[model samples]
Target: MSLSFTSPNKTIFIYDSTKTSEVALLQHVKDQTSKLTEVPINITSVTPQLLNSILTRMEPGTSSLLINKTSPWYRCFCEDFSEMNDFILKKTFVKFPSLIQTPIVIHQDEVYVNPSMKHIFDIYEEIYV
Candidate 1:
């Protein structure tokens, strides 16, 4: 049950709505994508399938990039997991979505994790403008 983007022009925004920063970023993405008449953006929460898709796109040894280091679950149990592999991290993220980073934007083959406004602008220009 992996997530796939069939349309090359489409953008996918995976985020945690509970986080204020992510919510703000989502609004910014919405504002930017709205200007594009054709390219559509899919905004969604981080599901297991979506998370796996994101993990696959990310570079090796960077699997923990999506984990929220500030999360309580992470702080409490992070040390316990001496062997924190992708599978364990995925399970942990599934159990605690709040423990995963927010506002990951996927545009074509590129996956932006917690992207800044500048990154969004660059993506817009590259894809739309």
Candidate 2:
């Protein structure tokens, strides 16, 4: 399945909850992406296609960084599973999208999984300027 954009805007944000410690940062990214792109950012939960796109396009390190290792969901998976790879993880995400991390930002051809403000800002500047 292919990921479809609801809007013509080129950015997509896969965020979990607003209650996270990164709420402020996520808001900042939303505001900036909106202002700079002149279109609302596409905020969504992790859908199957979205997860597939992320698994295929994003680097393994960045994708792994987004996972909440301490979450009960993850802990349980780790307890039962010994070997882990991108393929297995992708399947897991397909089943439990909520278990995946949040604030996954995607722009034109760039995918930032749980990135820092500096990284987002850099991309924004490069694209908008």
Clashes of each: 0, 0
* Best candidate (score: TM-score): 1
Q: Candidate 2 on 6-109: residue-level lDDT in tens?
A: 34345666555544646677677656555322111124444557566656666655556556665568867865344666677777776766566656677755
Number of the top lDDT candidate: 1
Local accuracy of candidate 1 as per-residue lDDT tens digits, 32-90: 56432121112234467867787877878776677677777777767855588778877
Give the clashing pairs for model 1: none
Assess the local accuracy of residue 22 in candidate 1 as a C-alpha lDDT between 0 and 100: 68
Q: What's the TM-score of each model vs. the native?
A: 0.78, 0.67
